[model samples]
Target: MFERFTKDARSAVVDAQQVARAAHSDQIDSRHLLVALAESEGLARTALADGGLDVTDVVARARASIEAGDALDHGALAAVGIDLDEVTRRTEATFGEGALARAGRVLRVRRKHIPFTPDAKKSLELALREAIRLGSKEINGGHLLLGLTRAESPGRRVLADAGADLERVRRHAEGASEAV
Candidate 1:
């Protein structure tokens, strides 16, 4: 399957790992893949741009998801009588400001070769299926984007949250794949 990927498609996969690492995530998921696709030129970028979604915003969303645990869940913990804010305040007071964030940064320094989450693997598989469905000899970035839209992953959720028209993106990606 990898051998069938176009250069842009392979680059997107490599860049997705970079995106995951930048987000301080231990594993790459579709959100990271989507960010990679959005940043890269070609059918995926065009499909996202046509939907009025900016690349910066998409990357930000993926980062937020991956780094969600960087900060304690104040509200949820507060409901359980664990005031994370108070804990942070006291910890910071004793350890100096931004101590927790510094620790988080240290812990986030992952080694090379971050692995993909199941959803990411599934999305890539779906991308191959998409290429086959479209009768394309090789998988391109557009097929990857279409795969993301079809999968139930954080990327798909972010796309919807960012007000991307899923059907519109699909149509545009399919059309664009033909031209590739």
Candidate 2:
């Protein structure tokens, strides 16, 4: 299936892996893919922009979400009346800056391989379907973006949070693809 991906689509997939690694994620999620799409220059990016979504803001929010999700024991300690901010500050003073975040990154890297999350996998599969439906010979970034909208995934959530209308974005992609 990947063999059918255009150069831009292939690059977006590689970019998604880098995004997942940078976020210290155990798997490549839909958010990572969305970030990749937003960063890329193509139909996907244009569609997002046309829908009134700012790519930079989307990337920042996605990163924040990843950091929040990856936080270790902050909520649990807070429940016990412990201030995680103070703990982190003291720990950083003793060990070094970003000690906790660094430790988490190390652990995440030690896994050697990060697989795609189920939602991400589904999005990729749907991308293929979208390409076929559009009568395209190869899958492109627009198809990938459309696939995210078709799936119930973090990518879609990010788009929604950024005030992008999925249907409008889809139409823009389709119209752009026809023009191409």
Candidate 3:
């Protein structure tokens, strides 16, 4: 399936891995793939822009989602009547600035290779299917964008949060691919 990917599609996959690593994620998820597609110069980016989505805002929201997951303990403690903010202030005063963030950072395990999450794998497979359905010989970034729009994943949610209409984006991507 990888062999069927065009250069831009292949590059998007590589960029997704980089995004996952930067976010300290153990797996390459749909959000990472979305960021990669948005960052790259291709039909995907153009389609997203045409749908009135800002790539920077999408990236920020995706990263915030990832960070929110990593900080679940903050919410958990609050539920248990613990004040994380006060604790952080005292800890930082005792241990110096950024003590809480530093401690949280230390808990993350760095991996030599991060594998794709199931949704991400499914999205890529869908990209291939989209290419075939469109009578294309190879999967390209446009197909990947179409796949993302079709999938029920965080990437789709990110697109929505960034003010993109999935149907409009999908049409734009298909139109752009036809022009190509």
Candidate 4:
């Protein structure tokens, strides 16, 4: 997995691990990862803040969800912190019944571990590239947030209504492509 990360991504993962520990969670979920990304000061950080989903707010929502035991399924994942429905839809569409199995697997994975899914990997790559274009040293939570926002999944309309800046995310991706 280290090989899969750019230096900055590895750093983000490290930060996520710390957040997981601080939260007293045995594993690092996407919410923690998003926080790590935001702390890393990447493109998604500014964009997400611009869209009104700041780290403090997201963390509060995640904590509330956890306390409410709302982190049950993918639906719960959204209710807690990662509000990008589009990405959830993509995960469902890409993995289908396998999505449930994979999500379970994700649950079983440790905070120090990175779950593997082709869609997740693709999204991560695209996000990291976007981070690089914004002069970020690593992939951050903002990048993951944008990836989810722009995902062509069932949650698209829901996320748009939530005010996710999909267009800005796309613009960043476009800039990343040009940089590449």
Candidate 5:
């Protein structure tokens, strides 16, 4: 699965792995991948911010949504008043039309269970491509930290609007690394 990654994507994966070690996790999930994508310098971050979003907030929301779902299952979506239409609107608002197109390409390469919505995956892949294009060998926590900046999710936009210093947090996460 890692082989499909471009050089920058591969580096992002490595950075995610290192971050996972630091976080004391066992595998690379989309949250880690989101952080990796943010740390990598690329369109992912640009598109996200351009559309008005934040990566950290996106992750936080994802966690919250999942926790809510864990307790409420399908009912959570109804109880929380979150709808696919709202999600779609948010995705378009945060990523722009180009991001959606790019995400489609990425979706073609991903597995069925990556957890990310099509929009998120597209943003991630584009971000990795941007990172590689910028000559970054590995995506770091800084890149992942930038996920909020690149994401096209609604919750993330709220965070960005709140003026979070996502880059600073990502830097801290990267700076505090442990050996894998």
Candidate 6:
């Protein structure tokens, strides 16, 4: 599948890995891929610009505490009487400050390579499908953006939170892909 990716598409994937690593993420995910696409200097970026969006603002929105889901989960636990905050407080009192926070990550060896999360892999597969659907011989950054828009992933959520119309981006991507 990678063999069919244009240089811009491949670079977006590579840049996603770097984005994940720089953010201290254990694995690359769709949010990182979205960031890479926003930063790409080609069709993907042009499509975004066509929507009157700022590349920096879009990237910032994608990077904005992807832990939003974690916060939602925490709220759900609270509603269920789990009270994670209280749990953390008690655990910290029993052990020490920041004990629970530092439990698993500090002692383990940090990886030199971060693997793609399931959502990221799915997005890549969807990109290929988008390319095929557009009758494009090779996937490009616009196809990657279309892939990100096609699925329910962190990338899509970030775009919504940033006030981007996903359907508009999709149209733009498809147009750009057709042009390519």
lDDT of each: 0.85, 0.86, 0.86, 0.53, 0.47, 0.83
TM-score of each: 0.87, 0.90, 0.87, 0.46, 0.35, 0.78
Model 1, residue 20: C-alpha shift (Å): 1.5
lDDT of 4 at 104: 46
Tens digits of lDDT, candidate 4, 34-93? 566656665545555555555466545555443333234456666677654666577888
Question: Considering every candidate listed, which one attains the maximal TM-score?
Answer: 2
Residue range with the least summed lDDT across 10 consecutive positions in model 4:
153-162
Cα error of candidate 1 at position 88, Å: 2.1
Write model 5 residue lDDT over 1-180, tens digit each, in one string: 334444555676666555444443333455555555555564344434443456556555534433333322455675788674566568889998556446644553453332444544554564455345445554433334343345555324434444655554434433331110
Better of 1 and 4 by TM-score: 1
Model 5 lDDT at residue 102: 60
Per-residue lDDT tens digits for candidate 3, residues 1-180, read 999999999999999988877777767888899999989899899988887788789888988877676644689899999998999889999999998777655555545778998999999989888898888988899999998889799899988888888898999999887677
Candidate 5 error regions (>4 Å):
1-62, 69-115, 161-163, 166-180
After superposition, candidate 2 runs with Cα above 4 Å error: 71-73, 80-83
lDDT of 1 by residue, 1-180 (tens): 999999999999999988877766778888889889988787899888876777678767766766674445556787899977778789899899988766766786846667898999999999999999999999999999999999678889988887778898889889889887
Residue pairs clashing, model 4:
8-138, 28-111, 37-140, 37-141, 38-141, 85-155
Error of 3 at 119 (Å): 1.2
Q: Can you write out model 2's per-residue Cα lDDT over 1-180, one digit (the tens) per residue?
A: 999998998999999999988888888988999999988899889888887778898888877776667647688889999998998899999999999778888898788778998999999999899888888988899889988888789889888887877898888877665555
Give the CA lDDT, 0 to 100, for residue 92 in model 3. Answer: 93
TM-score of 2: 0.90
Q: Which residue runs does candidate 6 get wrong by more than 4 Å?
A: 67-109
